[model samples]
Target: MGDSRPVYQRIADDLRQQIDEGVLAVGSRIPSRSELKRTYAASDQTVDRAVRVLKAAGYAEGQFGRGVFVTDRSPVGSLLRTGEAVDSPFAARLLAGSSAAPPLLWEATSTATGAPPRIAERLGIGAGDRVMCTRYEYLADRRPLQLATSWEPLALTEGTEVVFPERGPYARRGVRERFAAIGLPVVKATELVGSRSATSTESQALGCSPGQCVTVIERTHHTADGQVVETSDIVLRADRWRLEYHIAFPG
Candidate 1:
């Protein structure tokens, strides 16, 4: 823990490190506020404040009946190619002046409550299943670029209790890499694209106005057996981040 920060901040940072280090596995439940208070020897309000810090930093979320759970996904380091060939017709038009590097603002846990009903069904889990989620705000040359969110099924990550397990569901190596390590290699992915006005939270995260339009990319990942393993949503500031797709002509 860094000495320059406050005790609560240090506490939060330690928890974050544990998550990043796989001490806390994705989708695993965290100790209750009272438990934290007892462990940290702090007041209830202090523990609550620390938890809120974790949430804002994208480490955990509070589920009504299930308690707080760690999110599984992490931020994407590159935007150019996600191990998939670009072949969409609008590929050229989307890539004009789009750069690969984007500054990161925040990457922490996000609640899965806002997902559309259809997406919930596709995961083969009820709307109530604890999901490990991550959110990132991308910036180019210090300006807002894009915002993205990714989610993974908790059931797939059972037994991994670290906030960000080193070898569980969606670790630093990504879902594909983690799955492969566990003998569940991903073979393909299907993506859906669209656009919409920025929600209040999106606006705050992306540093954009509420009415500004944003690009939305929803992807469903599958394994060799065609089992849908995970789903992700990438939202970008329409004016800043542009999508580039490389197409192969079938002559």
Candidate 2:
């Protein structure tokens, strides 16, 4: 019984298994190209391909001029989907379980831009409608933790005090309260989560190699009458955080 797989597949499988078993612990460098070739009795091309496979699948990442290393996928923290964090999501992201946590900080930029088609649909508006689009970056202990881009229809906030998400008195007040200021209280929200490869921009800001795995959450807030007030796309390094959703029993 032999593993008739190609050299690259075999190499990748072996290293992946090691990572799964913690033999190749996080932050530790994997065998170099020369070493892998020697051990597998394979050519340089085969070894290189194997390494590429590892990097592509998010099991490892390479530092500039440094060899490939196992990625740190340990649970750095948890993303709590409740309370004020939901109100001011633009401010902080990781609300991990009780423990002395790193100080959280964030930055955001908002602009009057045309809504992309997807966002337009989420807001129940026509494509190219003007919307106040905002981008956010969250950091903990000075390290990038997450990224988000939010879109709010200008038609809903044009003459209000909360037009800009990061400006004015109502800034960072979360959707419910901010909209409530204008007599448009948000009653509920919906979220959809999925996985994808990190884009070049995401990888750089999150401090991970390009093509690494990342999680994306599409969220929308609505009024009691089902009016869409805000929508956003949230992105974070998949290996670095655990997302928690608490459900209450209808007792």
Candidate 3:
């Protein structure tokens, strides 16, 4: 007896095998719907459904008015857990197999708003307290790979040049440097990691299906005296990235 899988699933599985085995190269055009139909003796609906599955699985993407093409299928930079700070951006230099200049790019915007209950609690502030919120998207070779939002209590940065994260000289500077400039030195940090299904908006922003999962990293930065200076929520496509760690052996 032949395989019992549905026609669409069988087609998707075979295409995935070709992608995995290098028969389909990254960024290369996949066979057109008509071609696949002819090759598999399937209907238009079957081929269309198979292509959707490939897109959802990050194996391929359809270009409007053009055709579907294989995606990079490579993992973005790994997140390194280390002792120096809470979380360091694992970027360009750490990208595997990427020899291009500036392997990653950043698009970010900052807004001043009242903190929500959850964010306020994370930053040790009361709900509705004033805070500076900055949202960012990290792109690898112009493709969005990660999203993050950082929140800081306005009380700590008020009257300082660092109040507006993207407007001052301290803009885009690391947390420690920004804090040091404001007389609040970041001495310790903590992080928690989890995963959940992507929301509709998140999936749209990430070009993934809503059913896909995302990895979330919650990071908090603290001053030496235990003041919460900053807290951030980082989200990444679960299938496109991996977490890494570097630590020294105990003395």
Candidate 4:
């Protein structure tokens, strides 16, 4: 029976099948666009759309001059059981992989600005409250993998050495550690995970095509007395990353 799906979908499906079956090995270049068009007996636009689908899914990456190729099926970003541990830095905890690759590099920009209403609400502060907002991009081998925006109420850091997260003594430290430095220890964290279409800014920063779907992780950290200490919004390319959680059974 003929496939009921659109031609582009059929082409994408065939390529995806090959990738899943290992017929197209990781790092191996996929057939050129012209070649794929001829083989699929589809028009250039159809073939191009099929390839874009694969690219958006993170199954493939296009090289500027070289042809598109399969991407390694590796976890680009991870969440671990240690995420709630105060002594451990958040960035280090997430990037602690057994892979032989070098450590993930992060570029962050921080500014002392007023929190937006929604973020202020999450942080349990009044709307328009002063907050230190830091944006982060984590890259592996210079390839963008994760983006995050971390917020801390200025009340928690004012007059403290760790006030400016990227410039102060506690620069690059986790929320738990920074708060701990100021005698506010983070004892718990909650995260909400969901999916959404990437905004134009997100698409540009992540190198994903317009309207690509992404994974969203919203996290809130609490102090020992149940006060909200910090909150963050993290975004990752769904096609390029996977989130795994290790749930321990109670004794």
TM-score on alpha carbons, each prediction: 0.53, 0.91, 0.78, 0.80
Tens digits of lDDT, candidate 3, 1-251: 99999999999999999999999999899999899999999999999999888887778877889899998757655766676534455332346465222556788788889999999999989999999998988876676778899999999998899987667898767788888998998888888999987787888888777656788989899988899999998888887778776778988
Q: Write the per-residue lDDT of candidate 1 for residues 133-152, one digit (tens) a residue.
A: 65655454565556656666
The C-alpha RMSD in Å for every predicted model, in order, reads: 18.4, 2.5, 3.5, 3.3
lDDT of 4 by residue, 82-141 (tens): 454422333433434634244667888889899899999999999999998989887766
Candidate 1 local lDDT, residue 43: 84
The per-prediction tally of clashing pairs is 15, 1, 0, 0
Q: Which stretches of candidate 1 lie over 4 Å from their true place?
A: 1-106, 110-116, 139-143, 161-170, 249-251
Tell me the spans in candidate 4 whose CA falls farther than 4 Å from its real position. 83-87, 90-100, 139-145, 197-213, 237-241, 244-251
Best by lDDT: 2
Error of 3 at 60 (Å): 0.3
**lDDT per residue, candidate 2, 1-251, as tens digits?**
98889999999999999999999998999999889989999999999989888887778988889889998666767677764466566433444462325677789999998988888999999999999999999877678888999999999999889998878998777788889999998888888999999999999998877887898999899999999999999998887777877777787
- The pairs that clash in candidate 3 are none
What's the lDDT for candidate 1? 0.62
Query: Which candidate model has the greater lDDT, 2 or 3?
Result: 2
List the global CA lDDT of all models. Answer: 0.62, 0.85, 0.82, 0.80
Candidate 4 to truth, TM: 0.80
Q: What TM-score would you give candidate 1 relative to the actual structure?
A: 0.53
